[model samples]
Target: MSDEPAGLVRPDRRRPEPLWHQAEMALRDLIDQGEWAPGLQIPNEDRLCEMLGISRITLRHALRNLEEAGMLRREHGRGTFVRSATMVAGVRGLTSFTDEMQTLAVSPGTRLLLAQVISATREIAEALEIAEGDSVVQLRRLRLGNGQPIGIQTTHLPSARVPGLFEAASDVTSLYRWLKDNAGIVPVKAKEVYRVGAVAAGDASDLELPVGTPAFEVERITFDQRSPFEFAVSTMRADRYEIRSTLYV
Candidate 1:
């Protein structure tokens, strides 16, 4: 009798599903059942192929599907490891990171990477509707969903509009919540631009993605009833994050 793990058992040839799909399902079950815990590297490709009784090409196809689905993460030089579920956010409306995660029933977390007062550059000034060289509070943060790093975001806000923000930086988890409570600022509308790009070398480590990996560069201008109050840029992991939209024709 074979004593191999059930989740790693070979797929039945008589089944209707393709071999690659069967391999994908079997691997997913292994991860989901905690037979392969998160952050634990799975068997090497050669061994996995032997256990699953699938060819190298077939196994590679299955692995790619799992990576795209966020069930596994593949490091350039290292082996693949089980990972947390992917996070999906709707771009149809303006929502805070905290709000997005909560809606998805995932715990949201933020780590402040940098916070200081800086002069707004021409680009930032234009987006915030402020004068160039004007004082703005610059905040760089690492955003997490379910304890996994997902994005690196930087925001610039007109310092004159929100007094004492610098002193209270340590307490901020949600910028939107802080703005609303401290300065009565609420976003009436926002315009966002998304560009497909590669992750920068410096930011790749923070986001747990390889340098040159696909990423989304998002720029947003947020307005209150009075004026544009914030300008933000985010580099989010393409594997861990997705933007969903509903369309009607």
Candidate 2:
């Protein structure tokens, strides 16, 4: 196949959809059809504009949409290139990072950033269904997929419930697995909420993204049986991860 993108056809001006939207969809089709492989720099803006018969502004609008959707990556002083598609996380189950990565046939790794016993603050206590100032095991980790950092998660578990959890595992690849094996506690259900926000400085460094880049802040309270036991906050790279849900009518 040729490296150059196939010729583009000008969109209909009378269509209800905006010209930029049409252009965006057309470009998206090209990417989905594998005309532009991942990591390959696409043609320059001038070329793309000419090919699509659109102005630079319209082409940029399309490119920006794709970039935010994780289908493209634009680097300063370099060029715009195809980005690897984001990994999809189903909202149907309470699955661990390891399980999710395994299902995707990617290697899952974790680097422990912080692990200690600390007093839970009011927010943490409320999330874990414990009293303020109660002891909790705080665990912070960098989640990796295929050796690439994808997210940073911080978890707080009631210390009274899981005594010696930190001491039991020095190198924890999967907290859920360790909890099951050691404490016989398996999270059966969880209530999770997602919001979009700017990346924090520390998290941006760990996730290797620019500070203030868009991120998905996921807050989850996991339960064993009917009692909440673990509360976690995860900052995931929006460009590399997406949350998917299946709705039944």
Candidate 3:
């Protein structure tokens, strides 16, 4: 097929890198560069071995590495195919959904689900550090990556802190960007808690996932230079999203 890797250079034994590692890197580049797009079945093992001038052992090793890294999936009878890119969010950096997608070279989009002025519930009030029954602008949105639904986020902001937010909600693609530009709420930090759970019925429909599918439930409280600025809860597709962290010994 046209999407198959072409003009592949055989690994040089003179180089320090191992043969399998070199083959692995070459295939990774094809997937990352979108030359071999998601869902495209790759060339057969025998053909790839011939093309790369490698043995079945070396080719299989390279393929195994890619499969473990979530770049390819193998079918029992069918050949291996490239998997769609998974969106990775770090527990370390505080970045907006739009920024994250852009950094990964994916187009980001938002579909507003619900927007209204509401009285803050006790939980919402505490998260925003405001009084109970205070006015709050509530916005529910479906977050998209590459035009596909990836997450559903419900956000609450104090009305006093974000005047006219309800009216402008539909046009707000990124909550962080909107807060900084219009409400002067520059989020400097955030605390996020994650839980693994099954998707709710309504949310599953919005996220285009089967009911009771695995998902990531995240609750976050964002802070500005002054104080708490926004509170958000998100349901993200487990298959399409990942949370990453770094550790020190």
Per-model lDDT: 0.86, 0.83, 0.86
Candidate 2 lDDT (Cα, 0 to 1)? 0.83
Error of 2 at 242 (Å): 0.5
* Candidate with best lDDT: 1
Over the stretch 54-87, how does candidate 2's per-residue lDDT look in tens digits?
8999999999878765677789999999878566
**What is the Cα root-mean-square deviation between model 1 and the actual structure?**
8.2
Q: Single out the weakest 10-residue window by summed lDDT for candidate 3.
A: 1-10
TM-score, prediction 3? 0.75
73-160: candidate 3 lDDT, tens digit per residue? 8999988999886676544468888988886556899999999999999999999999999999999999998788999999998999
lDDT of 1 by residue, 183-210 (tens): 9999989988999999999898899888
Whole-model alpha-carbon lDDT for candidate 1? 0.86
* Candidate 3 steric clashes: 0
| Model 1 misplaced regions, further than 4 Å | 1-84
